[model samples]
Target: MQGPARAVQPDEVLKDPQLETRARDLSKDLRCLVCQNQSIDDSDADLARDLRVLLRQRLVAGDSDAQAKQYLVDRYGDYVLLKPPFKTTTLVLWLGPLVLLLCGIWVAVGFYRRRGAAQGETEASIPLNEAEQKRLSKLLANERKR
Candidate 1:
């Protein structure tokens, strides 16, 4: 009889159901190195299957969830974990957007200040000439009538 296709292959299942469950959960948080975007649990790649076996082995060998995940991280350089720990290597990934936003704001503020300076020299600080003042008054009078 054919059995169901499983994310955790039948042969890789641990004798202890509890440990197998832990392995399954851990697998969901592990990135498949081959697929890049898929978790080991969801990937059908050979590398993902190997990772699943390795995870089950680790759990059966008495490693806690954190220790098992750390073991994979150590072997694969943190890229194997879907959510990598915050550290020097990932600092830019964590802070890059905020840093870019601050830089943009600083640049925009400087540009605005320069624009204000240019505008000040043009007409912002100057009194209107008599002809311009008379034209403005006539326009205002026409607006009041409307």
Candidate 2:
């Protein structure tokens, strides 16, 4: 059985089959304000239902699909769009992850380089003096006694 939250409702169905189809398609492309992650069509929120009705009204008023979508986008901003267009305002949304990844890689590389330099300094070819060798031997002898 279909769940209570079906994408389209019978009561909201349009008389014109073609317009109904267009409205359904448009609804699927709209993000639900309340659900955030779900399309308006798939969401059970009251806001989603209101938006669906508004979409149908636009279609019934002879608005083209593009016009209707633009109307909603203008009122709600690009957040209402399920797939936002790549425009100047949304450029950061599209590239932010790549920018963060590159930054993380740069930080990791610098950390490793500094760590390697420290390691190289500690592993240098300097030889220990005789006094230091004798101190080490004395420490080892004390350890063995303990």
Best by lDDT: 2
Candidate models: Cα lDDT each: 0.85, 0.89
Estimated TM-score per prediction? Answer: 0.63, 0.71
Tens-digit per-residue lDDT, 69-93, candidate 2: 9999999999999889999999888
Clashes in model 1: which pairs?
A: none
Q: Between which residue pairs do clashes occur in model 2?
A: none
lDDT of 1 by residue, 61-85 (tens): 8899999998998899878978877
lDDT of 1 at 99: 100
Cα displacement (angstroms), candidate 2, residue 24, comes to: 1.5
